[model samples]
Target: MNTIQDISKFSSQEKTFVTIGTFDGVHFGHQKIIEKLVSDAKNANKKSVLLTFFPHPRMVLQKDSNIELINTIEEKKSLLQKTGLDYLIIHPFSKEFSRMTALEFVRDLLVNQLNISKLIIGYDHHFGKNREGNIVQLTEYSHLYDFVVEEIPAQDIDDVSVSSTKIRRALLSGNLKTANNYLGYHFMLNGNVVNGKQLGGKIGYPTANIDVKEDYKLIPKTGVYVVKSNIDGLETFGMMNIGNRPTVDGNHQTIEVHFFDFNQDLYGKNLTIELLYFLRDEQKFDSISALIHQIKKDEKTARDYIKNNL
Candidate 1:
């Protein structure tokens, strides 16, 4: 997939089939929409273009909403890349861009700029100034613009029974299995490895500190989790701790990962850790030895799960 950062800078002579949304998690429901879009575009001999936005509409319109996204913008792009899309246009979303009326957005951007021959949108999709546009408006515009508008019906969407919001809630509540099932894949954290206080090293469980740069990216419920990562093309299983060092009277939450049977320098490498299972909630142990003992038990549990399920 060719990713274009700014939609304004994109100009194509070939006609295109398009879909527009935030596409936050790129979950199974979203995947079905993209699959249809790509398939339809190919059947019509037109290019498939997914017009998603950065900063998300909520982040721009609802500043006090305190919205935490399931996937960062980069993560969303990576997930969409597997769908065989022709183009992924990540337009900058702002108050000014949101002010474009429904007709203007359709005629100017979709009809003229994107050269959209067909447009696919999910049910209840809204656009334009104050989100006044709806499926009815889109159909009307399509007739005037001489294009086709397809709305994935309410029944179709409801059948999937999954949404980004629900998935976020599931993760926040420590329901990893339900969240992953809804997502049709493992929920992941994308971050760079950084140096830590070396507390894990002292406990005989050296860890790599993960620095997730996206502030809006959602972190799962604080606990110990079984995780896996592909490091330099090798699958590595590990246990991750997401909590403060309560035993040591530490105050801030940290994400530290310790891989099993693998030792290599990862101080500065970017990594994507996929959460496989939740072991237990983080708690304050009586002493460092107690903490270390619990960690050993967690490691055994993780290895057993990895052995049987993975």
Candidate 2:
């Protein structure tokens, strides 16, 4: 998909079909909406476009206090691009922009700027200050602006509505199975390998330290997880520990990954850690030997899990 960061660059293309939202996780529900949008746009011989925000509007409007983001800007762009949409419009959300009224947002953005011939939105979507725009308001504006407005109804699986918030909660609580089911894929984090104190090496289990992106990202609660690490395009089963080394007397938390049967140095390289299952909570060990023994057990458990599942 063509990522349009600035509204001024949104040139007049074929008749546009658009949907506007944060699209944080791009979960299964979001995928369903995008699929329908693509289908409708194709039938109408129009370009399918997605309208989303960068840094998330809430981050700007709420000052420094913002909820944890499920996906980064680049991650969102990459995921949306996989949908085969014609355009992905990223609005640089700001306080001034958020002040616009609901009608102003639709009139100026959708109708005037994008020249939207058809608009699609989630069933319970809201926009503008105080989130005043509803399906009723959207329909009313469509009548006045001479455009089509469509709302995709809520999607449910096993009676549970799929949502980004729900998936985030599940992931934070270390329910990887449920979170993956909701996300339609394993939740993943990609980061550059960085040098760290050689504590793991001292203990005879070397690890690669991954530095996660700070903005638009939140680490799950400190724990151990069974993960698939993609290094140089090869996937390896691994066990990851994310937490402060409480037992080892370390002060800062870390994301350290040890790939099973991998011996090459990955320092300075990028690694994508795909979380597959949660093994256990982070805990303080009684001694270094105890920790080493537990790590061995975790490795065996991770290997078995991957062999049976992956």
Candidate 1 regions with alpha-carbon error over 4 angstroms: 154-160
Candidate 2: tens digits of C-alpha lDDT, residues 74-132: 77887898998999989888878888899999898888889899998997999987889
Of candidate 2, the 10-residue stretch with the lowest lDDT total is 213-222
**Residue-level lDDT tens digits of model 1 in 1-310:** 9999998888999999999998888987788889899999999888999999989999999999989999998788889998999999999999999899988999899998999899999878999999999999999999998999888753233455778888999999999998898888999998999999988888899999999998899999999999999999999999999988788867888999999998898999999999999999988988888888999999999999999999
Give the clashing pairs for model 1: none
